[model samples]
Target chain A: MQKTASITIRRKFRVGNLVFHVLVIAFALFMIYPLLWMLTSSFKPGTEIFKSASFLPETWTLESYTYGWEGISGYSFGVFLGNSLFVVALVMVGNVFTCSLTAFAFAKIRFPLSSFWFAIMLGTLMLPFHARLIPQYIIYNDLGWVNTYIPLVLPKFFATEGFFVFMMTQYMRGLPREMDEASRIDGCGFFMHYWRIILPLTVPSIITTCIFSFIWTWNDFFSQMIYLSKIETYTVALALRQYVDAMGNSYWGALFAMSIVSLMPLLFIFIGFQRFLMDGVTMGSIKG
Target chain B: MNGKRREACAGYLFMTPWLLGLFGFTLIPMLISLYYSFTDFDLLTPETWIGISNYVKMFADKKFVGSLGVTFKFVFIGVPLQLAFALLLAVLFKKERRGIRLYRAAYYLPSLFGSSIAVAILWRRIFNKTGLVNQVLALLGIQGQNWIASPGTALNTLIVLQVWQFGASMVIFLASLKQIPTDYYEAATLDGAGKLRQFFSITLPLLTPMVFFNIVMQFINAFQSFTPAYIVSSGTGGPLNSTMFYSLYLYIKGFGEFQMGYASAMAWVLLLIIAAFTGLIFGTSKNWVHYD
Candidate 1:
């Protein structure tokens, strides 16, 4: 009788575990189904996309890609992608280099009002970007930088984002001070220690900053929309908006196709560097 | 040079970029916005002293009030639901196992593209009358409306989209959960506490910090939410202005109508409101948030 009772309990436990796993898998599918639907719909014929409940395309074609690449007016979708990449690249470089340098200053160097300056920097994290939109627009307009990528890229070079600086500073403080002492005894100057010992040690943080910078810049819409008016200067976000506005239901196949294409690089980057991305986000959010 | 002198020089040199940005981009622009808020300056017209008229006028504007109401509803309802979903998922996925990473990635994917134009556009199609959501509803023998086009469901649809991207918060919650020592659970179990009881007594208390952080962050994001509403409504915030998010309304006022002063005033109000909410969170945190 005891043996039978034990067997029944074991069976029940196994069933419970199986149920949990099944539920988890179902929810995961729910989370990812829209993306799958979009991917399949991109290849489906225009009319069939709405009519079919199936994920598989009844008819597959490359017409959307061809039409989307041709783009609206004189500009091509290639131009949009190119513009996005260019801005993102420059922004990433700016963030990694400038944010680290600022962090290094706050972390390693002891100077007058350093704490005050650091406090100011952290405080800016709470300041909403929209609060400064009009003045920024005016300033950029005055400098003739409004239509160009400068408005998007220039601020990054200035380490306007304090989160990266804070992350790097925390990382630098955790490093062994013995290395700095050893470097100093070897006749290393401040810049020399930073270049040889510090910069290399902080590669993880820099890469983290780069990943975020790339993604944020790539996905940014408001600043790009406000600054870049010309179609040729439009980033993928703005270009996609144009398609939705102009075509509505007319070229949805093409719209879906381009949307998928726009998300491809981000998907690749995220999938490739998820470890760094996850680590960066988790570390960055930890009360810093 | 003396060590202090050398340190100061190096620090100043390294901080040059940020210092310049502080002055030019942040400080100066903030002062300018403050000045602009007091004056009636359109982008095209000359500035005229308004003397708090813009701030005063906001009280009478129905659209402004409606926008604030919509925003409040969104932040209160959407943020809590999103945070709850994130916490629940974090708890469910707390155990280590094979293939969890793939599941994590699949879940985190939406957040990575959460605010992207493409995602917003995809959301539009998914909620349309003949879209996937309605099709699924049809399979269940239920009728579905064109969710985005209707006044009643438009805002709720946007809120659902916000909640759907709860992955970022879930990850944070997972990290916080990991920080919690296992002894608490073991001790609770020794005291004859069940799984649900331990979760309430141990897990929830320990995860309060993360819960607080996610609430504040999600609240701020929901207030500033513009893209989904914009794309869903085709930038009109239409269907009788039900989907007119505060920021969208502000954008229309500033850029569309060229009411720069009015927009600046609105921006300042938003900043103050956000600051107040943040302050409230921090102030009340001592009561409920447990720290080790």
Candidate 2:
């Protein structure tokens, strides 16, 4: 009787486990189906995009990719990709360097009103970017910085991205302060302590900042729309917008093709540095 | 030189770029926006003082009121549902030992590209009358509405999109769940506590802090959601203004209509509302959100 009861309990547990696995698999498939559908649709002819229910292309073709590469008006998709790359690369470099600098000051340095300034930085993080839009536009217009990558990448140089600064500060705070003291005893100054001791040790946080900055800047559309008006200066996000004119004909096939193309670099970065991204997000949450 | 003095100097030097950016970009624009909110400056005209007329007019403006209601509904409805779904999934996934990493990456892929133009457009396609969603409904022998184009379901479609990208919050929840000491569960099991009881008594309290954080962040994001609505609605927020998100309407007012002064007032009001909500969340967090 005892042996049969134990067997029954074990069988119940197995059933529960199977149910759990099946549920998760079903949800995962649901989560990924739209993306898979979009991918297959990109390879389908323009007329076939909406007609097919299956996520596989019945008639595989590369015509959409060619048409998308041709781009709208005179600007090819290459220009948009180049523009996005240039902007995202500069912004990523600026964020890693400048945010770390500010973070170092906040974490290790002894400054007057340092806590107050740090609070102010945190405050800026909560403020909606839309609140600053009109005035920032006017200022950029005055400076002739509108329609330029300057508006896009220049803020990174100043460490205006408070999230990165906060993340780096948390990372820096966790590091051993003895290294700084040890380096100082050896006649190293503030910059030397930073360059030799602090910066190298904060590699994880730095990489996190770089990966996030690249992805955010690459995917950002609103700011790009606000600042960039000319076709020549359009980023990938903005360039994608040009494919779908609200009042006119929309090149859905070309749009899907180009979108898939545009998302490739981000996917590559995400797949490669997913651990950093996950760590960054979770760390930022706990610390913040 | 004294160590304190030298350190102070170095600190100030290090913070120079950020301070300049704060004053130039954030602070100055804020002040200018405040000034613009009270004026009638529309890019072509000189600044004319209008006092609280813009604010007063905001209350009377049908579209503004409609957008505000829509946004409030979106935030309140979307945030909790998203967080709940994320937590549920996180709880389930925490125990799974095999292929978990691959599952996580797959789930996270949507959020990575959630706000992109491509995804937004794809969302529109999926919600169209002849789209995949309807096709699936047909398979199940149930008719599907034109989800994106219809007034009744447009905003809900947007809400579904918002909830679909809950992977980030799920990650946070999973992290928090992992932080919960296993000894609690072990002890509860020894006491013959069921899974539901343990979850409520142990997991719920411990996860509150992370839940609060996700709530605040997601609420803020929902309010600021522009790209998806913009792309999905083809920049018009049409089908009877069902998906007229606040930011989308604000964009239309400021950029499309060039109503800089009115938009500035609208922006300040949004800032105030968001600040109040954030403050309220933080204030109330003391009661429910256990930090330790």
Candidate 3:
């Protein structure tokens, strides 16, 4: 009797496990379907997108990709892609260097008014971008930096975007301060210690910051739309918007295709460094 | 000779980039906008000081009032609904089930493309008059409106789009849920508590902090929502200004119309509104946000 009851309990547990697995798989599929639709639709002809259809493309073609890449009203996506890449690269570099340095000071260095300054920095996070938009526009205009990538990349160098600084500061706070003390005992100066010890050890945080900055800068449309005026200077985002005009005849297939292509780099980076992203987000929550 | 002074100097030096950027890019611009709010400073030539005229005009502007209403509608409605969905999904996936990682990644993919121009374009197509939504409606022998082109439905579409990107909040809640000890639930069950009762008695109370955090974050993000309305409405805030969000309106004033001073006033007004809202939440958070 005891053996029979144990077998029944084990069977019930197996059933429960199977049910949970099935539910999880269904939810996962639901989440991924939109992305899969975007990818598959990119390969389909413009007319085929609307046809109520299966997941696989019946008549797959590369025309949309080709058109999306080469055909932006007398200025190919190559230029736009290059412009975006350059801007994103600069922004990433500036964000990592400046944000990490400032975060280090906030996290480690003890000085008079440090807490006050930190409060001020945190306060800036609450300041809405809309609050300073017009004035910043005027300043950029006066500085003759309008219609350029300077506005996009320069603020990053200044730690004006506070989210990254905050994240890095939080991460840096959790790191062992004993490491800093030990390095100091070895006659290491602040810069050397920061460069050789702290920065290297903060790889996960750095990756997190880099991925975020890259994606944010890459996907940034408002700032890009406001600043970049010339067609030659347009980011891929701006170019995509400009591709569709008032006549309602957008290159839907090509647009979707380009969308997938544009997302590829970010997706690749995200998948490659997903562990860092997950850890960073979790750490951010704990700090909050 | 002085180690303290050297460290102090080094700290300030390390902070210089951010400081300069903040002061030059953020602080100075903010101050200038405050000053400009009282002036008629068009970007063309010089600032013509006009005291409170811009503010008075803004008060009478119908579009400003309408956009404010639209923004409030979005924030008040979209935020709670999004949070509820996120929390539900987080709870559902909070267990150590097989393929949980895959589920998490899939849910998060929307956030990756959430703010992309491509998604916006896709949204327009999906909700257009002859779009997939309409086709689905046709299958049901029902008629569907042009979601993007219709003023009534445009903002709603954007709200749905916002809710669809609940992955970030879901992830946060999932992390927070994991931090809750399983023993509490087990104890509740041992005490003859039902699953629902256990959730309310233990899970809900413990999850308050994350809920509060997500609400504040979502509110701020929703208030500043510009890209969807901008892209979907083709940067015109069209279909009779149905989708003309506050930020988009501000953009039109500053960039499109070149009313620099007036736009500055609008911006300051928006800042105050957000500050007030955020302050109200923070004030109330003490009662509901359980830290420990």
lDDT of 3 by residue, B144-192 (tens): 8888887888989988888888877888888878888999987887799
Error of 3 at A36 (Å): 3.1
Instruction: Report the lDDT tens digits of candidate 2 across residue range A1-288.
Output: 979988998798887877867887898999899888878888999888777677788899999899999976788999999999999999998898888999999999989999999999989988999888899888888888998988888888999999889888888888887887898889999999999899999998888888888888988999999999999998999888888772133457788899899999889998888887654353544445
Candidate 2 chain A: worst 10 consecutive residues by lDDT?
A279-288
**lDDT scores for all predictions?**
0.88, 0.87, 0.83
Q: What is the lDDT for B217 in model 2?
A: 81
Q: What is the number of backbone collisions in each predicted candidate, taken in the order shown?
A: 0, 0, 1
TM-score ranking from best to worst? Answer: 2, 1, 3
- Candidate 2, B1-292: lDDT as tens digits: 9988999999999999899989988999999999999999878778899999999999999999999988998889988988888899888878657778877777777888888888887898889888889999998999999999988899998888888888888878887788789999989988999999999999999989888888888898888889988988988988888889999999999999988999999999999999999999999999999877
Give the DockQ of candidate 3: 0.63
Chain A of model 1, TM-score against the native?
A: 0.93
Instruction: Tell me the alpha-carbon RMSD of every candidate.
Output: 2.4, 2.3, 2.4
DockQ of each: 0.69, 0.72, 0.63
Q: List model 3 lDDT by residue over A10-100, tens digit each.
A: 7988988788778767867765666677788888887778775456678999988998888565888889889999999999899899999
In angstroms, give how far residue A233 of model 1 lies from its true place. 0.5
**Who is ahead in lDDT, 1 or 3?**
1
Look at candidate 2 and tell me the lDDT of residue B176.
74
Indicate the TM-score of model 2: 0.96
Give the distance in Å from residue A265's predicted Cα in candidate 1 to where it truly belongs.
Answer: 1.0
Q: Clashes in model 3: which pairs?
A: A158-B18
